[model samples]
Target: MAIIKLSAIERRRLSAFATCLVLSVFAWLFTALSSQQKYKVKLLAVFKNSPQKRAFHSLQPDSIYATVQGTGWKMLFSRMNGDDNKISIDLSALENKNYVVLSTQLKQINAKRDIERQVVSIDPDTLYFDLSNRLIKRVPVRLVTALNYQQQFAQSDAINIKPSYVTISGPADVLAKITYWQTDSLILNNLNESFNARVNLHPPAEGNLTVLPKSVTVKIPVDEFTEKTMQIPVKLIHNRNFYDVKIFPQKVKVTFTTSLKDYPDINEDDFEAVADLDQWLQGYRVLTVRLTHMPSYSKIVKIEPMNVDFIVKK
Candidate 1:
């Protein structure tokens, strides 16, 4: 390949032409972007200033909408860049004024200095709130959780919720009516062991109330289970004068369900069967034997010979 070098005069002319092109582009851009245009942007509203003697029980229209106008470039950049384009407007100027912030009152907002755009209008044209005295009260906390255990397993104890009682603070009318606080619902499946976890408290349905200790601890005790059988001695009640009361098969077979963790601590002594001697003395030789006592967390499944035969001596 062959190459040729330009003369010094030609090079200077080419450089001058390049400079002119760059200058022309800048001039065109400045004129195009400087032209008057309209654009919209949102401004945040924070209303903390209220009359010294008044309090708020509720606030309506929690957000403020601002329709603004500005240059094309400014609007494009602001709307595209700050995804959170939020400009807070001071609203303390509106206190104890019949619970409202009118569209014309929007002028009291401090956004004029921050938002370079001119606000053309405000959405809703008005804000609303409920005013009343604040209050505090104590309420009980309730646990909300669903659990499923693996085969041959079950709960070893009752579900335990810490800080059973919580103190709630809010509007007097609201707190006075709330007697209990509920926890957020949770699900634990295929549980084969004890577990401890913290859960959030469910928020009140009304927007005017506040709850203390937003979360709570939950203790779920789980363990494997086993089936067991035992012979429970039956006793005859009433008819003190009569003695030597004979009940066929003096013991009743009691089958029960219990967790393996408490299996070792259980025995036949923990159960009992009883019959009414008065029934026998009343010309009823045959009577039904009842299983009256059982250990904690133990469920009776089947009792052999629900009815028993008996003979008595007067």
Candidate 2:
């Protein structure tokens, strides 16, 4: 090999190439450093397959902690393959404890090989929770009505519901305060026949209790209905010498029906039978009696012998 001498210009070119190579390496290092960052994510520790015997009233934080780690473009993308960022805690370890805390290991990191060795301290080493024992209870339902059909139609009858009780189940503390439950209002307006409905029960406002059976079946009996018309004995307000006028239908007919339970208490007086003959002349004959006024519980199915014949005398 012959010794070769390089010119100043050639030497300068060699130096420039070396400097470019060094800068390229530094640029790559700077880019990677900027792209990487330490992120803290909350890890939820859950006890799987925990025994039912464990109550909800007991729980602690020290039993769980989050894993600390560094995330970047490369690792984050690789995470989808098989790298799990989360870990599950053993619930059996929390038995009989109201609270617990746990310390987690610092996960993977990417940095200057030296910087990567730095360990990060997690803010919290443990988590807290409440354990409750599941429970079930039975509650009775009460039905209330604002309208009184019994008094309106002079019918002594009552509406009733079936399966007046239901079962409710939830957390023990939540079920303890619950008392009697109620269903939505059952409307009886214009109800000519019996009806049945499935209603839901609402739990008391302030409690953790949950109703197991949310809904109930109700059978409402409207009771048999009946009506009657009775002739009213009308006495003229004026003396006998008053203008000649006649009241027809000296007797009025009455009709009605009711539930067997109330049939005995029902009578002609329960209905008002009246005939209007004030406009009739002394010789006027043939009057009609009308029935009005009925108890709420009682429905006027129909006025038996709807028409009655009477003579009006003036």
Candidate number with greatest lDDT = 1
In model 2, the runs with Cα more than 4 Å from the true position are 1-132, 144-158, 170-176, 203-207, 223-314
Q: CA lDDT, every prediction?
A: 0.72, 0.51
- Give one digit per residue, the lDDT tens place, for model 2 in 66-115: 33334454344434553333344444544666543434323332222224
What TM-score, computed on C-alpha atoms, does each candidate reach? 0.63, 0.33
Which window of ten consecutive residues has the lowest lDDT sum in model 1?
Answer: 46-55
Model 1 alpha-carbon drift over 4 Å, by segment: 1-55, 59-122, 237-245, 276-285, 312-314
Error of 1 at 102 (Å): 8.2
lDDT of 2 at 197: 77
TM-score of 2: 0.33
lDDT string for model 1 (1-314, tens) is: 88878899999999999999999999998877676676555555544444344445446555566776666667667777864355343335435454454565546453444455666677766666676665677888988778788888788898788888887765676666677888998888998889898999997655445567888888888888888988888888885886877888888888899988888889878887888887866887687888677887778888887878987665
With candidate 2 superimposed using the best TM-score fit, by how many Å does residue 119's alpha carbon deviate from the native? Answer: 29
